[model samples]
Target: MLLANLMAFMLFGFDKRRAVRGMARIRERTLLLWALAGGGGGAPGAFAARRLFRHKTRKRPFVRWLWLIAAAQALVLAGWAMI
Candidate 1:
């Protein structure tokens, strides 16, 4: 989980830099894959970085899916804890 979050953080940073430079961007699927794999825990940091860097926060699909991923992760954790 820690490793996944770290990767997500770096990926987001890279994507933001690319965006600012008008370079090729990271795929949304790749970002979400990292999040869904366990980096969902880092969703907050990703969001904060998005805001701080002014990147991707306004994309409806990205915003919606990130929240969806985080909510699903929360429910999964909650269920696991209950078990």
Candidate 2:
């Protein structure tokens, strides 16, 4: 989880830098996968990097996916707690 969050954070920041440089961008699915992995492991680090890096703020679909991942993680945690 810690490693995943670090990777995700770096990916987002790298993507943002690429965007600013008009270079090829990272795939949204790749970004989301890292975010999901990070969130699944109980760290919002990717999302935090999102705010810190100002990446994907204007992309509604990406934001929705992030929320979806968070909700899913919450549900999973809630279910685990009930076990």
Candidate 3:
């Protein structure tokens, strides 16, 4: 899980930088893999990158919802870990 989150963090940061160059594809397969691998952190990380960099603002609603979902998933995982 930690490894997955790390990968997501790297990818999210990369995607943000790439977005500045007007590149914003989801890399669907990789995203799905990350999400499935317990890297729910990716969504929020992506959202934050977008917001902080002032990119993808048009997708704000979608990204905001995704971030919320990611947060919920992270909480669930944390709870699971505690148990």
Clash tally, candidates in order: 0, 0, 0
Give the Cα-based TM-score of candidate 3 against the true structure.
0.49
Clashes of 3: 0
Q: List the residue pairs that clash in candidate 2.
A: none
lDDT of 2 by residue, 8-79 (tens): 889889999999999999999988888778435423777888889988989999899888887888788799
Ranking by TM-score: 2, 1, 3
Q: Residue pairs in steric clash, candidate 1?
A: none
lDDT score of model 2?
0.83
Which candidate achieves the best lDDT against the true structure?
A: 2
Worst 10 residues of 3 by lDDT: 32-41
For residues 1-83, write the lDDT of model 3, one tens digit per residue. 56665565566567667766887655745643453455444554444445565554676655565556677787877987999
TM-score of each: 0.85, 0.87, 0.49
Go through the candidates in order and give each one's C-alpha lDDT: 0.77, 0.83, 0.58
Candidate 1: regions farther than 4 A off: 39-42
Task: Tell me the spans in candidate 2 whose CA falls farther than 4 Å from its real position.
Answer: none
What is candidate 1's lDDT per residue for 1-83, written digit by digit as tens? 77667777778889999988999999999887776775336665566666677777789999899899888888888988899
Model 3 regions lying over 4 Å from their true place: 28-36, 39-58, 78-83
